[model samples]
Target chain A: MRKQKRGKRTAQEKANARKNITKAIWRHRELYLFMLPAIIVLLIFSYGPMYGLVMAFQDVKIGVPILQNKFVGLRHFNRFFSSMWFGVTVRNTVLISLLMHIVCWPVPLFLALLLHNCVNTKLKKTAQNFSYLPHLLSVVIVVNIVRLLCDGQSGLINILLREFGKDSISFFGDPKWVYPMFVLSGIWQNAGYDAIIYLGALSAVSEELEDAARIDGAGKLKCIWHIQIPCILPTIVILLILNMGQMFVIGADKMLLLQTDLNIARSEIIDTYVYKTGIGGSQYGFASAVGIFQNIINLGLVVLTNRIAKRLTDVSLF
Target chain B: MKRISGERAVNMVIDVLLVLVAIVSIYPIWYVLIASVSSPMEIAAGRVLFWPKGLNLAAYRKLFEMPQIWMGYKNSILYTSGAVLLDLAVMVPCGFAMAQRTLPGRKFLNTMFVITMYFSGGMIPKFLIVNAMGMLNSPLAFIIPGCVNVYNLILLRNYFESSIPESLLDAARVDGASFTRFFAMIALPLATPIIAIIALFSITTHWNAYLGAQLYLYDPKLFTLQQVINNILSRTSSMLREDISIEELTRITLETNLQKYAVVIVACIPLVIAYPFVQRYFVKGVMVGAVKG
Candidate 1:
């Protein structure tokens, strides 16, 4: 009798909650109207594509409505698993992303640390302003500049190589050189702009703490190690979690520009592969399957990283 | 005395490294500028390094003669302006609404927007949707589909939530002013800095857009500036799958290298001119965004 009475009361409470929500909506009708446009736009643009992921299971005909198309259970995914392109795309994507994380991850932090130590305000501002310029340039322009600099025949690097005793390297043509060029040029382009977040965190470090360390006869480097780093560790943790989530979301646009017949083996990431086969080649179902594969892994990484970050450091994206 | 000298040495080292970093950052853009004016023969011969030899405006003259380049500029400018306005219109009011404590389903709406930042249906499905919507090969492809950037939306939301005081809202309520009036007359004015940052971000994003234009646009007349530049660069190179004779390829490549630099400079001119003026505000904007709500 007691349990039944409690359940009846909770059900009544749930009904009241629903009633309150409706009342609140009516009260804030103007605000709801304000949010309507964005909600509608997102539904059409963002969620529409999400809903279209069902095409991964369908043998989508060009003119047929998506639902009317024959549904093939996991056939595209199976075909993708058996294909030669699958290994190539996945390996290239994972390796390039991993390489970037390993090589390019600490560069901005290092840059921020160096800049934080600098006392001259004018020099600091000039360095920062110039550094941010590359981030503003389009990927197309940046890749064009990279090609000019690394051009096998007339590129400045090759020119310098020949002037010395070394043989000229085919930076674009050789698959071996692709990863370094990609990772290093990426650092050059983004390190300054990326450093801005760390710089912001560093600026918030308490001057009293630094002064206290200095009075203890700690050197500047020691102060940085003991005082500044500890203070900004939370920011670093949050940014790292965010970066991990983007591990599979490598810039496919850059890869497309960098790709050539000669270097496609190294540069054909999942995104470029989708563009090439799906849009250009019109293999819609297969490409959608491949794209879904990437999305699941990216989303999975984000969740896993957030969990780990929260457990270990008590800092998470959520 | 020893400790003081050590400190001086460290400071000197830091300054020197910073100066070097600045130089390295500026060098590529500088190289492109000089090469654009330098004689093609000098560039090919690797004689043009720091200075332009036999400098001339031949490349610019050739570029200006092309009607497609002019059309690209017009199309891009039109698209970017439309995009800025659309983004502000869609995002600002929505952000303000999201920040309101009394809004129904605020948690659900926030979650829906944030989920997009991490996951999506990827490129192929998005293309199919856009095609189905009849936006392919249309200028609306540039302006509409991507106008609602989730990051900017959250930035605006957080800015409003943190910066606008609860007392202000209560006072407005006491005055019997409606939410719409308070938003327009008070909240909108206070949110100008963030709104400007969003506009600046929208401008740069639309202007630099390459892949979307490449994917959706097929007509030469509708090509963006980046697409035009891409066409010029890829026409004579190994980047694309187009076939041509080796001698013809070399000839075209040699002719366009100087023009390539010119194309890059022209493409970046608007951003280069505007970035300095807006740099401080955007820097502050990023810092604000770093502090999560």
Candidate 2:
């Protein structure tokens, strides 16, 4: 009787384990179905192109197939590293991105806070709508507007300067002003749009906490500083980390639009260099090499920042 | 007491400062509008200040006179409309699908999209794919590849998850409503904010896209407004710098800059007019997706 009971118990346990496995599979089936399209799209568009990164190591000719091209392993990399413009481009890209992060990143946060604090909802909404107007304008249009305003000979800025008996400043042509112009124009174009995210964050701040702070004799600024800023710190940190991760990618389109011969020294980042060399010069191999190099730096930065963020804040982009 | 009055004064000062900053931010665009309407000679001589020196509709007339500009405008409108439609078709359904927690592999799908947000195949690979697809010189080149933006997808997905209650979906299911019926009747209405956000984003992106057109479009007739304006500006600038006659150069430069701004005005005006209607949706949509999520 004991042997028979043991046999039945063992069989039941085996059957139960099999049933559990089946249930687990069933539970996850819908998720897999939902994810399939996105995965397929990513594989085709993103991962499929990853194979072309091999061209960076090749001495590619336009007519010849990519695979048929001669393998000149590290030759492009070596050339790029040794190039005179490499250090300058890297410095310009990093500095400009860093400066933009410092100046542009906070403007939205401040704007959002101010908007949040405003007593009149209508006024806040009006300000937001007006401010966000520039975000929709094309980069080309924005650049043209900038050029119109700052043109030395015919620009509105020079016209204004002349009224004060000052010489017209060649803002676009001068190298010193290029970075500032890029950063400022960037801030103007983006601040309102970015503020939407912060405004979203502010709305999430528990009203009860603000009430408590107020009852505790915390003034508006103190309540905001103590209650509000801390609540949004996670969002800010994540944004900061993400910004750092994208440090290698200065907005190439804007830079290309803004490029002038005089400012080329300061403006030629990796992306613009890739465009000028690869597309303009038809040196696809060299451009691919530069792109791959930038990608590597970007990947490293993202991973590093993500790791640091995870450790410090318990939040990571991943 | 006195401190409260002092704080009010400070607030007033701050408010004025904010208004000044806002004006500064918007001044360049204002300057462009003024310059576009002012006499070219006055613009060149730096005499035109805050307003138009002589309001001229000549630039607008000149732009309209060019058949190329009209063609460009038509192409841009078609491209933007088509792209937005395609983007919406894919994005709306995809977002709805993602909101189903019972759906299999949701986390994995989310991770896949997030990965794409940072890394792309870069331009050459994308070009190669488009070339391989035989989309080169075709409007499909502009439409198909960027059919859905991952950021928009995620945002829309978040909106669906937050705004649409599961009990409502359950009630629909109990009433024998098909998945399509449920999505169409219940989810779609609730998704208006995200739909509007996506529409605005997609329209602006498609309208502003110059690089895609530059890459795949070869036919002059197919050139978008931005491309046409770009060519006009460069050609006119080159003509002016060359040994062209001053009379001809002056005539061309004035016409080109004026028409360029006119093009800008035309491209911007429609969207700017449409923006206010959609702006309310944007804040709510953003809060739902980004903040609450």
Candidate 3:
């Protein structure tokens, strides 16, 4: 009798909770109507493709209905793991990603700090604008400029090299020059633009704290270290976490533009590999498997880094 | 006295470094411009350094003669304008709705959007989906898919939440103004600066994008400016292959080299002219978006 009475009360409570949810939803129907278009778009474009990830497991053949393909149960992944291309592409991806982080990471922050320190407002504004100009150029134009500058026979860099009694380096032809060229060109293109985010953060740092530090005999460097750096540290950590999420997904567009028969060995990362096999060769299943593998690693890296960031700095994307 | 002098010295070092930064950043764009107007022969001989050895508009003339360039320019303008309009239409209402504290499932919607930023089904799936939709080889493929960028959505949502005062909405509700009226009149008007920022962002993205046009578009008639420029670049670069004789390579270089620089300058002219006007707002936009609203 006691158990039956308790069950009746709990059932009544569950019904009341459900009714409350429906009531709340009904009250916000207008908001739901406002969001309907975006919801429809995302469902068709973003979420629909996510559902298509099943093609990674299927033996997707050309001209066949994607859903009708037979499920291969990880066969493509097995082949990718045992393949020689796997090692080469994975190694190049990691090395290039690390090189990018090491060489290209701190530049914008340094540029921001430099801009922040500038006493002349006009000079700072002009310099900032000039720095941002390269970022406006398309990848095609930037790559073309790179090719023009590094053209072995008639390029500017080689011209200067020959004038100084040095050998002209074929930047595109040599495999070893691939990483440096990629990293350096990236820094050149994005440093000034990327600095804007940090500049925004720097501007938000409290002037009162800096004034206090200065009055207490703290030097400019000391004030920056104590006040400004600490204020912007959260932004730095957040951007770093975001960077980790994107580590595996390098700019395949730029890489494709930079790639040649000579430097393919060092330049082909997973994204480019997927592009070549999936789009170029029409091996959809295998390429999809490779892409899925890359995304999984990307997700894992982001989650792990987020956890670490949350523990250490309390600044996490989540 | 020593401390004051030391601070001056540091400021001097920073100014010099900043000047170097500006020069490095601007020099390549400058180089491309001067190279475009310089004589091809002088450039080939490496005589064209700081100044043009022979001033010429021949490259620009050659670029204008290409039918593909004209078509690309037309298509890019059409697509960019269409994309900006569509993006603003979808993102503004969605962001405004998401900004409301009274909205049901707000947290769930926010998470759904942000999750897309971190994880995606990869490129193959996206291509397959677009193919299935029969949007391939069409301009819709470029303008529609990937329009609702999650980061930008969040940025706009954050902007709305922070900038729009709760009292205004309360007053409107008390006066019995409909949600639609409040959004159309109050929210949209207040969001003009951010709307411009989003429009600028969409413009650049659409203008610069070629990979999608490469994948989904096959007809040269459908190509964007960047795609056409890429076509020209790859075609010429392939001629530099070792199989080609030196005379032929040099001849090809002389013809195409200046044209390449000319194409870059032409493509960038629109952006360079508009950048200064928009530069001031974007910094504020980034700041508004940077804050955890």
lDDT of each: 0.86, 0.77, 0.85
Among these predicted structures, which one has the highest TM-score? 1
**Residue pairs that clash (backbone atoms under 3 angstroms), model 2:** A30-B103, A30-B104, A31-B103, A31-B104, A31-B105, A32-B104, A32-B105
Model 2 ranges off by over 4 Å = A1-39, A62-66, A119-125, A203-220, B44-47, B165-186, B240-255
Model 3 chain B worst lDDT window (10 residues): B284-293
Give the count of colliding residue pairs in each prediction: 0, 7, 0
Candidate 2 lDDT? 0.77
Local accuracy of candidate 2 as per-residue lDDT tens digits, B48-163: 66788978889888776778877888999999999998888777877888888766456777787788777765766666667777888999887877776888888888788888
Q: Score the docking of each candidate (DockQ).
A: 0.68, 0.44, 0.65
- Mark the regions of model 3 whose C-alpha exceeds 4 Å error after superposition: A1-17, A208-218, B237-249
Q: Model 3: per-residue lDDT, tens digit, B166-203? A: 89998998999878899999999999988888888888
- On DockQ, the candidate that comes out on top is 1
Put down candidate 3 lDDT per residue, A81-180, tens digits, no spaces.
9999999899999999987875579999999999998998988988898987788788888888888788777678887788788999999899998888
- Candidate 3 chain A: minimum summed lDDT over ten consecutive residues — where? A1-10
Q: On a 0 to 100 scale, what is the lDDT of residue A170 in model 3?
A: 93
The DockQ score of candidate 2 comes to 0.44
TM-score for the first chain in candidate 2 comes to 0.86
